[model samples]
Target: MSAPDLLDYSRRWPLRLVLASVGLFLYLPLLVLVAMSFNDSRQTTVWRGFTLDWYARLGGNLELLAALGNSLAIAALATLLSLLLGTLAAIALWRFRFPGLGLVSAAFALPIVVPEICMGVAMLIFFARILPWPAGLPWPLSLGPIVIAHVAFIFPFVAVIVRARLESFNRETEEAARDLGAGPWRALLDVVVPHLKPSLVAGALLAFTLSLDDFVITFFTAGPDTVTFPVKVYSMVRFGVTPEVNAVSTVLLVLTVALTALALRVQALAGEKLAP
Candidate 1:
């Protein structure tokens, strides 16, 4: 427990090796998948030569293109909706002291902590069984249901992120805006909204990625005609993995990495703003 007895974990070779092994264990398959996307052979395991033919085919695949469109649309709409609803939720909880504040606040965390399968099933029942579908129709389940379901799960994440930003906020700024003859709405827009921008951007991107990558809930909510990229990819994988799928996945991998990096950059900027 003394200063000399304190272990230097960074210099520990055993710990460093384990960490390296864990990183490889997690990311090695992704590296292999990226390699396979350019494989010339039909066989997934055998690579005859590197070729970009699969990417060409991916561009021409109508079903996949449609699915990609659907995914992007759903993700964008869900992100916007979640940003609005979650920001409002965070603001309410941040600024108010309700009778059941603890209970209401805990409710926001449920979507994050609850199992996805359970949430999916709950969504299925809510959309299918609970809602009164027309007598003959299949309730016209499409991007609509999926967007709603995604917003339900995704907004809580936005709320948590925004609330964290709000916790660091200086109330004096808003008070100063009010003292300068600004109304409530003016104070929020001029003072608070500017402060929330980094969190908002970060939350929006996080929600977009979560909605884009989601499968379980999307699977439950999708109609016969509705197909998002993840669902399309899953159906293809059920038959067999192909180079085209690999190519699309590689593109998605790159996009995910880019978005993640952007989020981190925003977070770093936010940290700089918070620093003394």
Candidate 2:
């Protein structure tokens, strides 16, 4: 090989090594956690032999199951509401210029940049001030407040993702639909929404994952009966880490991976549709 070819080969190996290192850095811990979940030992670090007892035990944990149910319920509700509101917001932001557009955009984007603790505290305080009940009432943490808090934070992410999709979208199809005598809403529904379906799906899945994984905001806003899976996991950890926690974390990791894969698949399909 020539000198330049040798130099190119040297650069390629270093880049490959760097990428490999980064991949291991991110995934090695996950692999360890998954392994630990199946370990027969109660002690997390010390592995005795492979067994399914931890996962089996999970099914019998009533509190964990209840918390998981609450999380799924909240995430589902929040994802639906966020998708509806976020899609509308993204459309409005992309299709029309209105007064205080910049301000409106900033407000929608604020939650993405704001610290979780701050948002959590603010929501807690806001709920305290506005909730219509006697101050002496029992701790009013309930499904409603948890869902509201989740939607508040998760909707912004959906909006941002959908808005990105809208930015690259072709508007001529909408115009063509209108020219064919479709009304504004009809054009949006018939022409635009089909194209945006992938982004909408991806955004909804992302919002669900975020809501499910959220601990900080949920911790502050949750009422006595509204504890989510993540909060329960946090409570479990406060005592000590165990194989049970590992099993739970491994399950959550699998779920998150599945959702992320689904999101990416939708985005890929969208890209294929857009491609010539």
Lowest summed lDDT across 10 adjacent residues in model 1 is found at 132-141
How well is each residue in 1-276 modelled by candidate 1, as lDDT tens digits? Answer: 666546777557898899999999999999989999998888747878989999999989999999999999999999999999999999999998979999999988999999999999998898788873333444233567788899999999999999999998999999998999999999998999889998899899889889998999899887667789999999999998778888999998998888778778878887897795
Give the per-residue lDDT of model 2 (tens digit) for 18-106: 98899999999999999999998876488799999999999999999899988998888899999998998898998889899999999
Error of 2 at 122 (Å): 0.9
RMSD of 2: 3.4
**After superposition, which runs of candidate 2 have C-alpha atoms over 4 Å from their true positions?**
1-13, 132-141
